[model samples]
Target: MKRKKTLNMMSEEDFLFTFQHGDYKFVFEYDTPDEFREYLSELKDTVKELEAEKSYKRVQQIFKKEEQIEGEIKKGERPANKENFTFYDLETKFIVGKKKLEKVSASTYKAYEATFTKLKDFFKYERIENLNIEDFERFRDYLSTQVVNKTVNNHMAYVKMFVKWGNDRKLYPENNVQGVENLADSSPEIPHVNYTDKEIRNILEFEEFEQCYKDTFLIATRTGMRVNEICNIKNDDIKQDEETNIYYFDIKKSKTNAGVRQVPIHKDILERVLEIDFPLFPEKTDNASQKAILRQLYRVVKQGEGKFFHTFRGTFMNRCLKNYPRDLPIIQEIVGHEKEDKIKLSVDTYAKGYQLSLKKEILDSVSYY
Candidate 1:
């Protein structure tokens, strides 16, 4: 139905008409007959001449979102929240993150798995993206009940690592839980110290241990190698010098890439390395190697000491500092710590790696006398 009003006896107003735009009714009142006649003439021209009814009420509302997006690109405008990850929870993070990230070790991954499992049991909310500081704090309280202070602290560390990972990718933007601090370690500090020259001799000469232990322990003390690194050493890792008649152990792989360095063997320990054909500790795990090192440490250095195989590293560093305090790069190269050559650009990038002669000099300086 159409509604039209005629201005037969009206004062000064012209004729008007009403149209329906769906539920909304719009009435277009004419200002004057001349204007109305002009608009009707245009409408008639469109219908008769063009054969198209491109009128206002018949227009389709086309969205310009794609066009707007194209315009933004042309104007150098970037979009926000375009990351594909919805959010990674504890389980997914543990599985995927662990596999993808090489920095995290197997032991660290295990701890993360245990920590996340406990947290999952404690909390109802699944996705970490939705969690806030209060959620973590409450989780901390729950951890305090179930584990020792040290273990609870470890749980907190795991949570912080996960949160940091999420924040880096803008996943857990609100989970900046800074208050989850570690508890103070109340246990008595065990005395980890450098083994005296005589104690080193005693450990080397200990009758209870086999020749293999003496061979490996001597290598560890001289080269400042971790017990794990020592255990993993293969026969192929040993390389000899053509000029100096000096032999070297190439630590081709280790805990960190930084740990991969060639160490010149001491004259005193070189004879023992010659006889080694198998892996230093073929079937031994890190835990087993640690237990053996601790047992020997207790015997040689006496009980209640914090020192293990790692004490050799500190001992080597101490000797280096005493003799050549400023030579940090050398000591760091010998051990698995970060080295200077890795960061600084050299004049000759091709010759940037340390030469065997320079390596020999450094090892000789730090040698046990």
Candidate 2:
């Protein structure tokens, strides 16, 4: 029979009650009928709630703990450590933080990051600390086996940067890894300047590309814009002076703030700009669009077969050299260039006040030359 409070007031002395279960005990005291009943109900609920809470806490504690292997291996049971690690694994972390590891451009960091994967494969079994000058030299020699001097030089530079970063961070303390020297001494062939009048026609008439090339070429040749500078052009960048018949483009200096200068728009390019209905890049018309229109140009142009858009810039510069005042400061403004040199002077001379007139002159020269 379950125990309860006294049946009468005569038996009012408090009695202790104890209950036992596996790994748990409960004890309480009660004197009155109401007190004993309420205490009994409360104790039951408390015990169940505590058990549920303990189970929940145990589950949460397991998830918070890091996993550790506990099983006995038949033959390969050993604690995992850095002893057997490859150089490539450590290099990954370094490359991700490579820019922060050393202040470098995104493209430079990306190029450096690619070298680590190749290095990892080259030094597959060797640990990072075990690498020395010989290992890197051997890898360099392997790279030299297939690539040309320029390509080899590019890879060598990236690897050297990696080594410099590793050394600075003391990643490989045991090994004093002096990076391999560039062995290839051959200079790359410098192609002769062939910016002829006829070449300009070929570049302009080469319609086997996209509207981007056409638009960009028009801007580059007529306005003498740099590759990246032209690429960065926005619709909002154009500023016009109808009364003076002069057009200006608000531009940021790509090379330096000092390089910033107002460009006078050529009339031919101005007309072309007016003709285009929508954003220059239709698919992603937004300013932050990543698509390079050049790559898709071939599909757009129905006439010409194999011409690149950049050749227009070359033609434009050559035209500038031929027509404008070669030593004019206007050349720097037109070309969006930082350094003023002989080439710029030549361009300035040929392309002075390069507007619709100059563009027509270039086309006529191309036609007649």
Candidate 3:
């Protein structure tokens, strides 16, 4: 038997051995000959176990476990002893810490909360330390069954974040989730469907649609705001520009800095909004309001398979581009899109954006009738 082969001898006491078994390769380091012999004995035992099990996954787990133990020993930290600690326990602590710290926005925090809820449901009572790459693969399989590939990727991203958080805190071994990868989002990429003027009219005039849904859809189409931004509008958010006396939506709090802008209300919806006093939709959760809008939209529009509440935004942009193709900067400002082109970037750096009156003109021009 090839008993001991030293690949690199850094010193008389230090030894680094590169060992390869079939398709698997591992590097082991020891401070002394005695330690090297001890590790060799452990390696032999692992080989015997692998031979008995003949499972490639078990082989990975065993080697990864050894590496984790070695890593902890090198760092002068005790190896993770989380036999009683569970995925639920770590997730609870992580979520509570996130909430207490207020590190993320409410919407983002809600997404994290939802992801962890699914993780808890799937991984119930599973030990955090025992979770290896295979377990995460299993979790991904479970997520695929529950949601579309796109949503599964989102959940997997959150899971990866959670595992990384645990590793950073030394709560678990880093190798536990080392090989997990998100499933490919093979779902067909549906092109953004811009609602035509006729389709828009049908949705707004449908007698079955609730008044709030109509208002929400109208606001979205007119202002080009995201569903969350539209739902978050308040009475105070409606402001009149002092210089031009142009009334606009003062979107102060937004998901992005570019989203925080004065979106001039279109002339078509202005009078109706003023009649109802600013907040067009009734006070309700953003998610609920968004769902209501979608439900109403689907009921009225026959060609709404890929279309959503956000499609109204696409329609707004399409109309703007159709009318003012040269004034891309103004359109981008109105829709709260970041100026990415060199010309737009230069304009953003030097200019405070188009005047509210100019924005109003552009928005008023976007007519469905």
Q: In TM-score terms, which candidate is top? A: 3
List TM-scores for all candidates, in order. 0.66, 0.52, 0.68
Worst 10 residues of 1 by lDDT: 76-85
Please tell me which model should have the higher lDDT, number 1 or number 3: 3
For 1-369, candidate 3 gives per-residue lDDT tens digits of 233444343364346777888777878888668998999999999888777777877888978965764554344333443545666666555765575554456667788888888877978887777777888899889889888989998888888888888778877666566577777889888777778899888877878766767777788878899888877778888888887878888888777778888999888888877765545456756666666667777787765367777788889988988988888788888988888777566766677677888788878888888
Name the lDDT of candidate 1: 0.66
Query: Highest lDDT: which candidate?
Result: 3
Deviation of model 2 at 345, angstroms:
19
How many backbone clashes are present in model 1? 0
TM-score of candidate 3 to 2 decimals: 0.68
Q: Residue 174 in model 1: shift from native, Å? A: 2.8
Model with the higher TM-score, candidate 1 or 2: 1
Give the alpha carbon lDDT tens digit for every residue of 1-369 in model 1: 122244444544345655443344545567666887777675556445333334432443223543544454333222233232222243454455466556654556677778777876876455565567777788887888877787788888877877776677555456556666677766677777887777677777788777667777788778888877787778888888787766887887677877877788866667778888757556676557667766766766656666667888888778766777776676677776775654423512455556667666666665554
Candidate 2 per-residue lDDT over residues 33-106, each given as its tens digit: 78879988988898888889899999877654312111111111232534443555455445445434444434
Decoy 1 TM-score against native: 0.66
RMSD of 3: 26.9
